[model samples]
Target chain A: MSAPGAVVAAPEGLHDREFGPANAGKVGMWIYLVTDAMTFGGLLIAYASLRRMGNWPDPAEELGITISSVATFILICSSVSMVMAIRGAEMANRKALLGWLGATIAGGVIFLGIQYYEYNHLVHHGLGFTTMEHGNNLFGSTFYAITGFHGLHVLSGVIYLTVIWIKSLNGRYDGDASHVEIVGLFWHFVDLIWILVFTFIYLL
Target chain B: MSEQSHSTKPYLLVWIALAVLTGIEIWAAIAFDGTAKWATLVALAVAKAGAVGWWFMHLKSEYGWLKFVAILPIIAAAYAALLMAEVVAR
Candidate 1:
């Protein structure tokens, strides 16, 4: 099997680290994301069990779903932008690449902003990692843990994308987009995980 | 790389599908209750995840061990669910 981070070395005729016919580096990212999914899944499974075990608060009534849904839409849009960035990278369209990547980063930062507001709203209402006024008052801890972890991923993605955007401006991704596409994988994974988290934590 | 590999049409379609599913998810959460609501919401979430994974993430084009590696989590989740169910049953 090929080594992690080094998907089959540079082809004989090609220069170093250039993607081969398969762009297997993207696949490597996918594999990494799969493992990341399991980590989130385990945390979620524990959360589900906790909700079942406790007299948890009504998700709809206690937590703000409308804003979260809006945040969800923003992240979804970021995913779209991420794909556009990948396409731009693959086609070597620097303008489109940088533009779409900037849009994605903006979307992520906005998401974080909305989340910060949501967390503040909840905390002001007396719900947080250590305290809760609603049913299953202990639910606050798990709620924060799950969402906070996902929030950190968004923060990281934003930083990662900002770097990519800057480098794109510098012509780093002109000939090859293996790096941008990989970052897109991570960004899309964050979006995908939010889908599951939104359903399980907020909607369901 | 194939020229066809760099298209945006499929990504747009997936994005639209995801948006529509999310709309349905919010509506289902409001419209239904009990097990039906949970089922509908979960089903929609799964569909959205699949679209993102299959299209945006390009798992559809990946194959072999790469594919298996990408799919490993679902298998593990299923196993964990069964184990948890058994323990709960006891």
Candidate 2:
């Protein structure tokens, strides 16, 4: 099918036309999210297996959902701020972008902080990864592995946004406002994954 | 540049609503019992996920190909969910 501008067919799978770096970035993030979703799927499968086998202990005895819930809220808020940052960048309001990006980074840091706190809290409750409360189960391992990987992604994204934020102060990317948009896409993907994580690990 | 409006209000409002929904989730997590809690949590999670995908990620703004990209994984997730139900049900 041909459009108004250019009639370049995007083949079977690849993006049809180059959508600038921002569009490319967003697309790349979505691709990454698909793979990450599979990983979470595997983890959820494992969780189901363990729960079926009667492996998981009581929440009051083993894990803390409240902390995870709070982190979920923080991450969701950060995603909002990230969209604002992208908007600011598009309007060439460097100061507003920086402020929003800084907020995003702070949210990432707070997420990591709370993750560690929850980790320690779980350990204190006698659920430190290797130790199993009810049966010698894979609950802790799967839980830590899944959430740990997600946390690492958030950390890397935080660093990426921070660098983007610092470079914005130097006025390097004047016309490429899509860079922030791409970062927002990545950040939102991270937030989306956490939404799944929070539901599977905590609520269900 | 594309003429897409860059207003941040929709995403922001959705974010606030998600936060409130999360608060309700936590409250229901502690307050409710049995099937009621499970049903509420799952419903809220599905709603929140939809908002994030539609608004924050701008999936609603993109071409159909993007939706194709998104729906494939979700289709796989449906199968996975079936497997989960089978495993947990046994």
Candidate 3:
């Protein structure tokens, strides 16, 4: 019995507790995503500004749309897998969780691979940041900058989800999925951003 | 926590819709020109993004406060719009 006015201390192992709301971790992730949105938004807006102001190169002349389109489809499929993973987590179905997470990670990597192939192709065809077949220099710079930044995000997302995948196999997040859900938020955001990027940089 | 476990149906449906939208975007990009084309492309892109966010991300079921965080991107869009206008004006 703790005395009156005494600071009641919790037992050694039971002292730790969740310090915030049940969804605090998700809220934190959302906050981080908000900041990320601004960063990407700024870059995209800058790309738009340059396109509107400068003599932009005909993307059709240099970039490959078919490949990027396929990549975009892969990412969309990956997001579906991510959703499945979350649903699996909610049900404590380890097999579904691991399978879907693995699929999502594979999707990210394949997207990056296609991006690498595209970048190499563009560079081989004389479209460097400072050197483009078109007289305008800004076109290459903006395209590379916007798409490259997004690619980096995809790379990190792959690594992030891969960690989550391995942990799921080990049943680390059993009976809970806040962490998986948060990663799914990030994965879907990347896919969303890519949709915009594909339209702006490739299609427009 | 979700009270009921989700099925694969919704994910599958969203997947088919997104794939179809991407095909349309490609067609619009190649076929149209000028502002009309740009408008269509942007609209399709927004639709695709919305589908991914609302369904795949499960933002629809998320807490309201989290949805409110979307304001950050709106601000970004405002900034982009304003800045692009400035660039064009100059």
lDDT by residue for model 1 over B5-61, one digit each (tens)?
547778877888888899999999999999799779978988899888899888787
Best candidate (score: DockQ): 3
Q: What share of the true interface contacts does each candidate keep?
A: 0.67, 0.66, 0.79
Judging by lDDT, tell me the better candidate of 1 and 2: 1
Deviating ranges (above 4 Å) for candidate 1:
A1-28, B1-6, B87-90
Query: Candidate 2's error at B24, in angstroms?
Result: 1.6
Candidate 2 stretches greater than 4 Å from native:
A1-22, A133-136, B1-6
Candidate 1 has which clashing residue pairs, if any? none
DockQ of each: 0.55, 0.56, 0.57
> Which whole-number lDDT from 0 to 100 does residue A191 have in model 1?
98
Best by lDDT: 1
Arrange candidates by DockQ, descending.
Answer: 3, 2, 1
- State which candidate has the highest TM-score: 1
TM-score list, all predictions: 0.90, 0.86, 0.88
* lDDT (Cα) of model 2: 0.77
Task: Give a tens-digit lDDT track for model 2, residues A1-204.
Answer: 432332233445565443422254466667778887788778777776776676465553356676787798899989988987887777777777889899999999999999988888777766657766665547778778888989999999999998899989975444446667777878888898888788777776
